[model samples]
Target: MAIDWIGFSYAATLALGGVLGYTRKGSIVSLIAGLFFGALAGYGAYCVTCDPRDVKISLYAAFILATVMGIRYRRSRKLMPAGMIAFLSVVMILRLILSLL
Candidate 1:
């Protein structure tokens, strides 16, 4: 099985973001959310690595993050966490979709 390096990198980025958020702002929510989603992404990557056609977990995770972060970015008009994450999520969604084609 081939490694899904991009997906793994995304998961690491997400987990790191969470850690950064906690360290910078002491936001437990950010930590939890980040780790949770990171784990989900990591697992999804594993699934994709084992079976490239199985993208359900990764797609769902990316879609959820894109929707939620997009809303947050829209409401807050901030670019750091929300906007960046939303953009990344959208990119991931696109990547996943393209892989199916």
Candidate 2:
């Protein structure tokens, strides 16, 4: 099976964000939200890369979610989640921009 590193990284970052969010916030809601959003974004990355039909919508949603989470983390003064999500969001945004070229 071919390894999808981009997809893996996307998923990992989101999942990590969730874990960190839960750890930092000490709330189950953060955990659930993180996992849900991570899975959604990871699936989006998979669809965008593998599917021939433009799955750009998913990428947009993922980006938005990531950005929101990143801001949340930042506001909470949690460095890891904030930094991870911020970087991941930027990378995804760059990838989306490049795909347009």
Residue by residue across 1-101, what tens digits does model 2's lDDT show? 33446755776766776787678878787688778767877777676667624547556755786678678787887756566677777776777667657
Each candidate: how many clashes? 0, 0
* lDDT of candidate 1 over 1-101, digit per residue (tens): 89999999999988999999999999999999999999999999999999998999998989999999999999999998999999999999999999999
Task: Please report the candidate that would top TM-score against the real structure.
Answer: 1
Candidate 1 local distance difference test against the native: 0.95
TM-score of 1: 0.98
Clashing pairs in 1: none
lDDT of 1 at 18: 95
lDDT of each: 0.95, 0.68
lDDT of 2 at 99: 63
Q: Report the number of the highest-lDDT candidate.
A: 1
Off by over 4 Å in 2: 1-3, 23-25, 73-78
